[model samples]
Target chain A: MTQTKIDGRAKTREIKRKANLNLLERLYLPEIFKGLSITFRQIFKPKFTFEYPDVKWQPPASFRGRPVLVVDDETGVERCVACGLCARVCPALAIEVVADETELDKERYPKKFEINMLRCIYCGLCEEVCPEEAIVMSKEYELVFTSREEAIFGKDKLLTPASKLKDRLEFLRKMR
Target chain B: MESILIAILKAIIFILLFLTFSAVLTYVERRISAFIQDRLGPNRVGPFGLFQPIADVVKIIFKEEIIPANADRTLHTLAPIISLFVAYSVFAVLPIGEKLVIDGKEIKLVLADVNVGFLYILALSSLGVYGVTLSGWSSNNKYSLLGALRASAQMISYELSLGLSLVGVVLVSGSIQIDEIIRSQANVWNIFYQPVGFIIFLVSVFAETNRLPFDLPEAEPELVAGYHTEYSGMKFGAFYLAEYTNIITASLLVTAFFLGGWYFPFVDIYSGLNPNLSAILQVIVFFGKASLIIFLFMLVRWTLPRFRYDQLMRLGWQVLLPLALLNVLVTGLVKILL
Candidate 1:
């Protein structure tokens, strides 16, 4: 064994070929006592358990949850321009969009937009491909459906308020 | 006739107490193990999960009982019954405290107080092996058979040391009767006289109870629940109850023999108190000591990993047996010399 000084601290670099057991170690009882003491002390330490259902986990900004259409808070209209890039980029083919002329400055808007949550892989590819930053991943991960019809999320279900998705939008802006 | 009636009443009360204690022990074991691992155990069912065992019993009772095809039906049913029976019956001879006098009639804390109490305990505990063995054989499953084989072999190997270790206690106390042994320890506890024997006894008891570090019979990784693999519903619950009961019995025996049963050390505070009150205090003190040993049992279970079968065998026959015998020899020599 050799000792080397790194950052003013001695670090042993050598590895022993075999462990040399002393008389006390070979006897086994002393080692057993050491292990017992460790567990005994741990009984007083704080628990790491999260009582699920009663207490829920809040994921961080980087978390990629369900995809949603961002609804503008000021105008009360969806930010989607109906470019069909999200529909094309979806690997699961979960998204669908129908374009129509609108009175808004964007000119084109989705007449009918839907995302089949059942088929969604949650890959965030749609969120990445969208040029308008209209579709982004929201923090709402709890998706439950009773039937196939219910699983196909329509405009009402997919459109989330922009203010509610600020954390994910900010994270995406910084990362992108 | 009156003595027989008193014995029956005592037996009923003890049985109820043991059953309740074992149920509470399951909860305590889970809570303690969780604390050791930095997790909260089952605290959802009730406050601190005290009612978890009751929920478990209800679930087990409602579950569908499944006996494998081509398995011997009689022995399959009989195995768990035997296990539970032996676990409960061993306590019959265990002296908990000194005599209680009520209405000018004396009552012994122990149910039987048999003269051969020591031999009786040894005999009944060995009989507990039959339950494990029969369950494995009757299951007709390879894993169950392997578990039963391991259990019987381990129990038989450790029983030698377990019996021999107590011989030192018998020698120091000069009697095989358990109450006699307790009476002898009134001056000084047997652990001070036979520390080697105590260690050997403690180790052997761990093996005998099929606890962790020696639990080859139910080694989950290898044997897949061992002898109870094919058992389900209340039948499996029977085996579970029996295991916890064995732990309590082991703790009680350790307290009675080595830690000085029901006697407060170096003092006789009971001399000035009422006889009935003193007897109740003695019973409380005995159980308090036993619960400490029980805590040690739970601690050891969570501390050490299971020993390999070969290592377990070597530790039993090669190490503990020789040590127990030497302990007896030295204890006898000292008795004659002094």
Candidate 2:
């Protein structure tokens, strides 16, 4: 503790010494003027920025984006088997599942699945944990709105129909 | 009736001038700092975002003015008005542009050619602390009161050095009138002769204005919103306006004292020009110097971190006060000897 206090005072004196040096430098003024000149030049230089909304930026291929549930095209239904794997894998405890025995060929499916997007850490472990090729993480990142209800992606919001997979895949392909 | 009309016109001109300059200074302070820090600031509104100030004005005008129920109603309303008035009134003594000749009748550049212009400026500027202090105290909040106390003490402490630093100029020029001081520096600017006094004066101005590096009163992390914690809408805007006006006033004073007012660099070449043209040139030159000084203020703000309240007080009492006094003493001796 004594050593830290001594070190702090020493640092302060060093700072004062530097300040004196700066004062000496300002006595010449030309050196400071030169620095100002460089800043003035860069002030007018064209800024490097891309237009957003109209032109979306493409992130790297390994970039994880929004999470979505996969659908079976041949069966014309969701591929999820009500296994509760997604809920278990989510580190944030963001995902919740409510499975029920449905009349879709008597296979069990989620009756009421809810994922709180605010709590979601976007870990993509949900996709990895799904037994049947049911969940997939897509590259659709710009998700924002006013209401809390809108932010929470339910089973209806998470389950991207089979028809939309082709468009999502095309966007992903173009990003590369 | 004619004198009253002229006086009314003069008041109108000065008030409009102060408000307009303060508005534009808000834009300039932001833009200049951004430039120094290598970033573009406010370039999306009007051409180069010149209308950003106008947009700010509109926003402030339409904003909901909130008054806390527990707060003192009269002082809360009066605080910003007092700040705005004191700040705005100081500009009457400040000469902005070149003298104009209308119908061969010569009119001076300054709004009011007060004989004791320097004293007027110092006295009015000191009054600005009251507005800040009252707002803070009347808020019935501890943070606001603390901020106000810091502000009042800081302004009062710095006012001494600020006044003393300029004492050297008053001693050398032998005139409290700003125009006369400008006239004294017609040959060589006072800055060249009394650089130490100028430096001391600049530092004190920074402290007195409660700007960055001396902005301990409103240190956002420490004091939250400071004295204006409960202020909103035009009340908040008034506080902001007062600050910008103070900056402009400091810049003008610096220009009038250190830099020759409206005196162009190559006046020898322009000496052959018509008297009217010469005056116009001088006005532009004056404003150019003031603008550069304002730019420097913005630059230093971005470059330096704020001083702690204790450090600022110590610097004022221990360092700047003595230095300013010494400058006056030395200048006096030199004036007597020479």
Candidate 3:
């Protein structure tokens, strides 16, 4: 950015005074009529109304909705090693994880995981910070929670089968 | 007794029709404004949102009425009623059709048929300022007071041009009665002779009605709800109703003065039909002309930004008032020459 020698108020005032008009502009009616004519023409223009309830908008996988935990199709278990990276990176302090030992190749699994939907800004930082690509933004934008307890999403709500998360996974891979 | 019966019947029928038309206008305005902005307006209320106004009436009626503790109770209660009364009262003298024949008796379509109908309308419209001003003063709020002042000042400033513009029509027609004015234009509309005056009158009517581009009193950015800031529930509804009613009254006045009220072009060709049928057709024609003017009002509202306070003042005093006087002078000269 180029630094100015002085404050720009004087320059703006100069530009304002410089934009002079002739006799016709002084009349004002012609310009008013021109504006009216343009708006009159717009009466026949096509309207862009999305009847939202009847017609649901299916955004592409790259479109971030809400973050979800990815489950491995082969092993029928979560791909997450319960790493605290997401919890640490979440700006809103929305994510919580309790790690426990597991028998699987991934030695650690989250015994409990909760995200306070109220606190979550949906910034996708937690998803970005995940090392294993276990948490990714999903296509579940419509979220309505009546109570505080209902808003705190747990593992049962977060863990989606890998098959359902195919589009988002492919999208992330393409981006990388 | 017979005349009184006719009067009561006419009043009942016209009031219902007028209120219904105002409600429908709200729906039309929303739909048209939405189309202009490339968005769908309210369509979910009912079939094409036709029943939306009914729903609105219900909502407004049920809303709790709130009065500011410091507000003048008597003036606050009386203000909106005065506005509504004035708005509806102006329609009393406007001639909508020729004489109606029933049971071998003739009945004039207008309610009062005041000898100086045009002057009466102008007088009543000026009185409309009191309603707004009172609402503002009684509310005891700063914004409301400013709005009230703006409204009164703007109305007074534009009323001069408004009156001057109509003088062209009055001079050309050589009559003050609205019926006689329309009758005078059986051959040609006054708009042809007084084009400049017609334009001035149209602009002044926008200002008079507190419509957009001249809606300084209720400028949302500057004043929150303006004079009606403290008004709630049915009282607020009355103000809203008064506003829409004023719009219709202004359109009707424009029709009566410049557009030749019920006098359609080539009306002699259709003269062979039944007189009753012809009268109905004439009323329909008058309504058609008025609707076009009303649509223009809506189109303008969506098109133009609100004028700055000083700009509004300048346009009213400097531009329109002088132009109206010039038009009157030219019209007078032409009348004498012809």
Tell me each candidate's TM-score.
Answer: 0.95, 0.81, 0.94
In candidate 3, which residue ranges exceed 4 Å CA deviation?
A1-13, A16-24, B266-269
Listed per model, the TM-scores of chain A against the true chain A are: 0.87, 0.63, 0.81
Top-scoring candidate (lDDT): 1
Could you tell me which 10 consecutive residues in candidate 1 chain B have the lowest summed lDDT?
Answer: B265-274
- In model 1, the runs with Cα more than 4 Å from the true position are A1-19
DockQ of prediction 3 = 0.71
Candidate 3 residue B3 Cα shift, in angstroms, is 1.5
On TM-score, the leading prediction is: 1
Ranking by lDDT: 1, 3, 2
lDDT of 3 by residue, B1-338 (tens): 99899998988777886798889888888888888888888898979988989998999999999888899999999999999999889999888888788989898888888999989999999999999999999999999999999999999999999999999999999999999999898889989988899999999999999999889889988999788888989999999999998998899889988887887776564367777888898888888889999999987898789998898898989999989999989888988898
Best by DockQ: 1
lDDT by residue (tens digit), candidate 2, A1-176:
12223564563322224445566575544664665566566566775444365568876545567888877777768888789998998999988888989877738998878888888887878876777757667767888878888878887788876665665445545754
RMSD of 1: 4.2
lDDT of candidate 1 over A1-176, digit per residue (tens): 66565766666576666589889999888999999999899999999998978888798998888999999999999999999999999999999999999988999999999999999999999999999999998877788889999999999998899999999889989999
Indicate the residue-level lDDT of B225 in model 3.
Answer: 79
Which pairs of residues collide in model 1?
none
Error of 3 at B250 (Å): 0.7
Order by TM-score, highest first: 1, 3, 2
Clashing pairs in 3: none
Winner of 1 and 3 under DockQ: 1
For each predicted model, how many residue pairs clash, with residues at least 3 apart or on different chains? 0, 1, 0
